[model samples]
Target chain A: MDVYKNLDWEAVEKLKISSGSKIVLKRDLNFLRSEENISVQFLLDGEVKGSVDCHLCLDNKDIDENSRNYLYPYFTESMNILLGRLISTDPMLSALKIKLSPPKCTIYSKTIDSRLMSELVVYSLVINDFDFDVVLNLNLTVIN
Target chain B: MKEIIPLSELRILVVDDSDFSRSMILQILSEAGCQLVTETNSAEHAMKLIREKKPHIVIADIVMPEISGIELTTKINDNFDNIYVIMISSLSQEHVVLEAISSGASDFISKPVQKNQLIESIQKIAQNISKE
Candidate 1:
């Protein structure tokens, strides 16, 4: 099964409702090295097992430390809501019994860990005029 | 005049690993006129706080590091009385909701919780608490 094709973008679009931000899909991987990025990984387990990583970048360079700290959690929670909606609302995902782990945030690094999945290509999600890059490293395999 | 639901009188405890989720929840509760609110990052610590704080309501995230909210609900049901558990999560699957209710949660709420929904849930519980 084509994982990306089967997945529902509408369910993921629930992020817009949660964050009160409009999301636009961008083809370019426009993440800048100069800007500090926040990344978090949510581990998925069950018949389909793997992980989803979200890398978020802010447009405003002048944001203070306190604001950055606040946005970090907001980003994680936004993704958490999106993933949960995807699992529950998506017809394909809801049929399967899947368990999602709590999100584990990591220090911002430009490198994508190749050991998990080779699809380093990211879908840039522009939210509230800021760029949010989502990298899905899901190792999709049916476990019997 | 009908007696108003004393949302301020109900002590609420929020348990979630994400600082953002907790802050959002805190802001919602505060805006809803709830004054006595306590928050914890882990279920283990939540259990400890329950012993000391004895909050009337517990709003917990289903996904966590050490112990999950479901396990915490079971613990609360086994040990405590007159305390209600509201299970909150991004995983809003029917089975997950059933599991939460079966685990002894009084209510289940999906994430990005609406302020009105939360307040209604709390109000229902508050009314019950007032009667007791």
Candidate 2:
């Protein structure tokens, strides 16, 4: 089965959070996406890091300043949910021992890690007007 | 108020590290006519409230700071008698699910929790408790 096809995107789409609510799942790992707003990385056993970013995935850009500050966490939460749901449905991915870190608001574009074998390729999800680049920095052996 | 099987009498505690996730859960619970709902951002506070307030059901995130949902569930099972735990998280790994169920979770709801699943799980646990 195509692993990309197995990843569920329906649940996220059903959540009509507000205006301009939409999500696109890019199967091509190399799929070029836009800038980042929020990113969450899942590090598995110090080897693989599965990163999910909701670059500018906000439905209501017009939300008040106070609401906007509060809303940033929701984007992070969305990325968390996106990755969690992806792993849940896929058996192979779930079997690995992974430690999920708290979501982070990424500023700099994701770059290469020099210490060990890593990769930054996963499904880059673009929602609304924002870009969420998901990079899994791990050996390509795991990808296959 | 219209009578429903899952009444408003359920004292529930919502536990998660995310303010957004907590608010979202509270909104859904309130919409379902839940009267007494408490929100906490982490497992430690949730444990304290579970002791003081003694909620019937706990909707918690599996991955949390300090202690994980699995650890919390184990503690609750070992100490509490009638508390029902429904672990909700963005990560739905098989081991996480297994550990949650083994630790004493009544149900495991994957994050981005759906309304139907949330209601059904709560009601099912309620119904089972009533049967006993």
Candidate 3:
């Protein structure tokens, strides 16, 4: 089968992650080519907030939950790659004010903060029994 | 006879704030038979390495702590007369690219460095070296 037929870009957002690469996933096409990971709402420029959350599968079967923390940098680099694809495909945004702040990672907790409400548009995919998701929670803005 | 420079013979420095990015770039360069490649997680350290090792090419990320890639490029332009800077970033905005070039980048590549893309860049730079 031709894998090229399955690869194409849809639309995407140009948001940023805390200390991560520039945020570029805003739609289905771009997300399809990207790896899985998480992005929160604290990074975007406007009052419109929420995170571009991503899900990715680890290639190494050796990593268990205990060593999962070791994969943090990988996930960050993956985001950079994904964002690069979007930018490469779209050259028009080069002139915008396009301010980018440093990536700010938040520890997961049980409670939702003030600016982010949980309005979610979620998509899920499973390949070879490994599942992935990319979610955009617009109401899920972050305060930072 | 005129001499030719291959990617393997060139000295390179990979600069980024992320450890994974540095490792990933390093892996790609190494796989392409690059012999002299060094990596630093920040632009500050990049300057020191540039002065010490004097790599022919500097592949750098734009958004970084302490020093952004544009500033670093400016520094290189001012002090380092012979080094070529390649700007890499997740930010694809037009203004950002222009800023990088104006600041002294010889070329620009977006993040998520692909092997072919990098090799092609190295070849282009190597060709320029041969020409000069």
Question: Which candidate number would show the highest DockQ if scored against the true structure?
Answer: 1
Docking tier of model 2: it is medium
Candidate 3 structure quality by residue, lDDT tens digits, A1-144: 121122233434443322333434334433222222434322433321333443443333445665456455555555555544443454332222444444554334223221343443334322233334434333222223
Each prediction's RMSD over C-alphas, in Å, is 3.6, 6.1, 8.7
Residues B1-132, candidate 2: write the lDDT tens digits: 433435488889998998878887887888899888998998889889999998889998888878888888888888899999999877777777787889899899877777778988998877655421
For model 1, residues A36-123, the per-residue Cα lDDT tens digits are 5668888888866777777775534566888677677777777787778878888888777788998898766565443544534344
Comparing 1 and 2 by lDDT, which wins?
Answer: 1
How good is the docking of model 3, by CAPRI class? acceptable
Q: Which number leads on TM-score?
A: 1
Question: Which rank order by TM-score, best down to worst?
Answer: 1, 2, 3
lDDT of 2 at B59: 92
Better candidate by DockQ, 1 or 3:
1
For residues A42-115, write the lDDT of model 2, one tens digit per residue. 44332234444334423323456675575467566766776666555545556555656666565444433323
Off by over 4 Å in 3: A1-9, A12-67, A81-95, A107-129, A134-144, B130-132
- Of the candidates numbered 2 and 3, which has the greater DockQ value? 2
User: What is candidate 1's local distance difference test score?
Assistant: 0.77
lDDT of 3 by residue, B73-101 (tens): 99999998878999988766666788899
Q: Estimate each model's TM-score.
A: 0.85, 0.72, 0.69
